[model samples]
Target: MATEHPAKARAPHRRPFQVATGVLGDLMFTTGVLLALLVAYSLWWTDVTVARHTGVAAEHLRQRWSAAAPAAPPTGTADTAVPPRFEADDGIGFLHVPAMGVGYQVLIKIGTGEDTLAEGVAGAYTNPYSSAMPWEPQGNFALAAHRDGHGAKFHDLDVLKPGDPLVVETRDRWYVYRVDATLPKTSKHDTGVIAPVPTGSPYTVPGRYITLTTCTPVYTSLYRMAVWGSLVREQPVDPDRTPPPELRKEDPSNG
Candidate 1:
């Protein structure tokens, strides 16, 4: 009879509270896991898409450079006519480099007025605020590009040495330049390293001068690496004349 008291039936209904708490905890943990997965997937997809688009843009530029050929001669006799300024749509007609396998379409945008530089493509390293443009006769024709490891637009710039040939083909003519010197960027000097032609210097020069600038140490932007080349030769585009074996077809075959 004493045992019949049965310890007051021990509150049999309390089981529901424990079950509810376990269910809520599990739901919360699952939601957190799903949210984390979504975040990771979003970031990875973004990076992959950007890289793919960059490669496509780079290849398109290279192909345009390859397909361009010099302008044909006049139907009749020799007529002297100054060509128009370079433009992006005109295509890159010529490219030259003997030391390393390098070539690309030379695009010229208006340095004055609006932002003419191509989007997604590397820009000329020179200051955009300056009065001079890349193709201007006396202005700084500076160029900018991503290092080889990332975008690698001008990866071979470091390989250029003195005497290396640099030829740029426009619709009507081939502008040739010779590598003269390489300068390491410095903070103290006003050498106008990125200027198309050295300004404020005693040397008075004519024609076009090209300055190739890129991230220093091959793949880093810690310092600017520049290669200066002067106009060495100028050849008129003659459709009747065949280009040199090296120049006729794209060298390196791969841009």
Candidate 2:
């Protein structure tokens, strides 16, 4: 009776305690999520917007060309190559690279600025650098576009093998070029590849050339990847005649 039953003991309540680095860990995780979202926006959202802009640009070009075209005069048996007109705000021409893929085409624009290239079009080099126009008899018409994002116009450029047809369609002519060589890696500042003779190319003499350039390794810009081509023939625009056989062919890289 004097000593009652031993008093029952209760376990102590335990609660999680914040570590010294808990806040830092949370901050790091949040930053990672933001970066991922940015990438997704660049890769997906930009593509959707560029596609719409490209459609608009192509339509505007069609309308302008249609208005400028007069009743087809009898084109005599001669080189009826019409000079391509470049518009600062419109498409200059359309590129068709069959070896890259079937139904592959991209509009060529005037400037290589971020806004212009983001529209899913090839940008002609100008200012501090220049490129030969498609109508040029002997020069390099070098162009650049995105390889990984912002429409990725030249994503499949690396797939093009030598001799693949690279067609440039202007208002009144189709300048056909044949892929001569490709440079898988080169300095981004190397401007010689866009030269009239395109140094380091298979040919050293001046000739009608076209150089397609984009970032290399698919997703990084540490280096540039270039595809050089020589003008094979200039096909006069004809409503009756279909595209050249080279352009009509399926993806040669596949077969």
Candidate 3:
């Protein structure tokens, strides 16, 4: 009888669907993981980083102001006080919001550009209204800040309603503003909202206005949410005086 060899064993062949399914599953899993990581970094890591920067910026501002403090004049000399001229990146004032945040305060840096935003909280817009200050006579003091991350300074801005309190503190005085109106959705490039008299706002005559801008609808940058108000009260600062009644409390009643 002739010698016979066992037929050679053959490798199994995979169907096209089986191969495609495996590859697709791997791609989906990887995409999901990356998305989750991005969300964590936005909601958690950026806040932590920005908070530390804000603290350092705040201390620096206090030190600069203290060093520049003038000595008391001799009897018979006039007080002759002068207002401060803020430069780019300089901490000009503190933004205080009661309804949105009771004890929270953020530094208002000079320029609303990227560098100032990276430094602390909100910055004054550099276009039409940048030169306008809380102490100035008539113009809008436009401000911009992040809604979710990078200090998330204006995260709860949506909660503001008519009559809410908004105040800015400078070396000499406190400028108080009342929430007159809110525009929930506006085109990002609509610079009119930051105009001397915001285009769609109620004000007709030029006045001391405050316009606060932030990205709208939580995480998307598709539109802007604005809160506009007019200057209602201003009082010279005194060493012994405490903040206005609004700053010392919260909306426990809202709960």
Q: State which candidate, 1 or 3, has the greater TM-score.
A: 3
- Model 2 scores worst on lDDT over the 10 consecutive residues at 70-79
Model 2 vs. true fold: TM = 0.84
Tens digits of per-residue lDDT for model 1, 142-173: 45544443225456777777777776655455
Q: How well is each residue in 1-255 modelled by candidate 2, as lDDT tens digits?
A: 465445433544444455536777899999999999999887988888888888888888867867775434425533444554556645778899877778888999888888888888999888446777887667888899998778888988889889788999877678889998999889999988888888789987888899999998877889998899999887676764357777766646534
What's the lDDT for residue 106 in model 2? Answer: 93
Can you give the TM-score per candidate against the true fold? 0.52, 0.84, 0.85
For model 1, the superposed segments whose C-alpha errors exceed 4 Å read 1-79, 85-95, 102-140, 187-191, 199-207, 240-255
Q: What local lDDT does model 1 show for residue 4?
A: 45
Candidate achieving higher TM-score, 1 or 2: 2
Query: Ten consecutive residues with minimal summed lDDT in candidate 3?
Result: 71-80
**Candidate 3 per-residue C-alpha lDDT over 1-255 given as tens digits, one digit per residue, 9 for 90 to 100:** 865554533555789999999999999999999999989776788789889989987878767756666533323322235456767777887899987765778899878777667554788988755548886778998999888778889888899998988999876567889989999999989999999988888889999999999988988889998999999878666564367666656645434
Q: lDDT of all the models against the reference?
A: 0.52, 0.81, 0.81
Q: State how far residue 135 of model 2 sits from its true place (Å).
A: 1.6
